[model samples]
Target: MSFDDVLQRGEDELLSTRPRHSLSWILASQFTASTVTAFSKLILTAFYNVELKGLNHLDNAFQYAKDNNRAILTIANHMSTCDDPMLFACLPWRYFFNYDDIRWGLAASNVCFTNKISSAFFSLGRILPCERFGRGPFQPSIDACIRLLSPDNSLNLQKFTLPPPILRNKPSWVHIFPEGFVCQLKSPHENSMRYFRWGTARLVLEPTIAPVVVPIFADGFEKIRPEEIDMKTDYLTPSNIGSTITVNIGKAIDDNVIKSFRDEWKNLCNKYPNKDNNDDLSDELKFGSEARDLRSRVCDYLREQVAQLRLQNGFKEEDPRFKDVNFWKRYTLSRGNSDPDIQFVGLNWAIKEYQRHVKLYNDKGEVIGEGKSERPSNL
Candidate 1:
């Protein structure tokens, strides 16, 4: 077999036991997750004046998902690198005891899996290394999430048969930062969030059963680990220790809404049956224009859900321009040239270079042209 065949075989085997860590790994992961949870609680309680609202909403969603054997997908904004594992500290202690009940999160592979030691550590913590700017949402890690959410559903990207029935029985929980980047606005009270990535849409559309979707809005984490910190040496150190961290958990998205959205996606797939197939490629890539349109729609709706939570918490409505990717790309590039924060200089440059070559698409999904000369008017 060719090298490509070997890689394909490996991926198949990995997905066969999707999200199920080995005995040793599970034990290690449980220990790591528990320790982190305890540490997070201590730090937040001791150093920060934490205000967590809507715990009952989270409790209701967790219980409903557990009772019905449904997968849970918790979506939140990414304000700082520590937004996760730290944000989860708000959950009650009972959540820490059951390893299965804990969340499996996606961390940027470039940042979290830079070396073998960090890779192993993060993996044991139930964190999946995702290629945020590389292979992107279509990579195997995203597929692993899909399989975990809906093992019975066969994806277009599947290269082998489904996993064992036993493995498919238990539903898992997944938490994603739909914004895909740590976005610190001009002020803490600013309600703006970056555009929701299409990966989040895949988590919702591809699942056989719609995962219970819960939106969370967190503020003050930006101060805990601001982007201005020196990425080289200050990673372990927390800044603004006494900053107030407010966490708000919104009610789960209504089941009927998710069902209707899935149905709409299904209709689109049926309308463009052959658009997702590739004869030369072993695994199908769902890059059809119709699929992209559906994904965009889903992402917009999901962003709105999170935005609503922000508004409910007394923040003003976000600027209409915040939903545009180009707007943020321009903003980042401009800041990279002037910002004194050296830590994010490289990241901002990468965004700048990416935007330079990015194509501009029209409403019909045609690439009308590429590259814009003018900056966004609001910027």
Candidate 2:
């Protein structure tokens, strides 16, 4: 078998299990995270200057989660593929506001969980791998996310025995990028932070969960490594070293914000009685007008908060980069690094696996079962 086949088999095996972390694993991961943070501080301080601000906000948010037994849903802009690690490096783990370090996050399966090695690191970090797109009609990743955020029902004592109180009572801090994809900074809208997906807003309004939403404004990572630059080659190169990045945790969306959203949802529900059940409100719908309107309004409010934060962070709209689509390209070209070759080991491996799967299953243009009637093909 080819190396790609091996990676595919490993990826498949990892995704088969549900996402959960043992208490011992969580503690070990926290220790690793703390070590990474310390190393990042030391190296970045000596080589590339690092500045961390608005940590008090993170403290307050974590404190709130601890007090309320509620989960924390942090919505941040997706600036770079390494934002996850950057967040891990910058956030405090042990010293002050200690327990704030323990957190869980979602990572794209195709990109982040392609092979056993990467899977080990991400799983230890408490990351749940999600498929960006599934081959079949239904998306397993979306279903996993919904199940994760939805409330737990453990009414049956015999059927379900919850974990220990310490583990059970721990608040979940889920980090999400509402932008859906990494901002390429290729268009004006992308540069201005105008495009935001409705996933975060919908989760906030979920009746069963209704997690407190926190907006995070991140800056300067682009300076360290622009999207046009290759992640493996151009990022952190000699020329790009010593650049700075900032992550500012904003205040959580309080009760007033939730109340406003709830009021709007109620009004829309009253106007269109049957539309409350629909969740896909990305576009206007004739039948589900209430869900559509509520989604739009909630998304608008959230985006506005992010936009205000960008402005406050000194990202001027009149900047030439916003108007110039080839701004980063021009910068990269002028810097004399024209080699477009980039390599991401995990993503490349995952693509190879996906290709192999498609070739095997989709030879006849439509996917078909492979072996026998008695045992169905899992893929």
> Count of backbone clashes for each model?
0, 1
Q: Note the residue pairs that clash in candidate 2.
A: 48-242
lDDT of 1: 0.69
Q: After superposing candidate 1, which stretches have Cα over 4 Å from the reference?
A: 1-21, 151-169, 188-191, 274-285, 329-379
- Put down candidate 1 lDDT per residue, 1-379, tens digits, no spaces: 0112222333463433334435665677789899888998888888888889999988999889877777899999888878978898977888878776878888876568777788777876777766544344566676667656753432333554445322323577889998877777564324368889888988897665678999999988878887666666777777898888889999999999888878887676555444334221122226777677778888899998988888877788787767776766666667644433323312442352333334444544355655542422221
* Model 2 per-residue lDDT tens digits across residues 285-379: 22265665566677767766666677767666534332232443453334313322322211221222322212224522344533222211232
Off by over 4 Å in 2: 1-24, 95-101, 133-161, 164-168, 186-191, 207-209, 231-239, 263-289, 318-379
Would you list the C-alpha lDDT of every candidate in the order shown? 0.69, 0.52
Please report the TM-score between candidate 1 and the true structure: 0.79
TM-score against native, each model = 0.79, 0.65
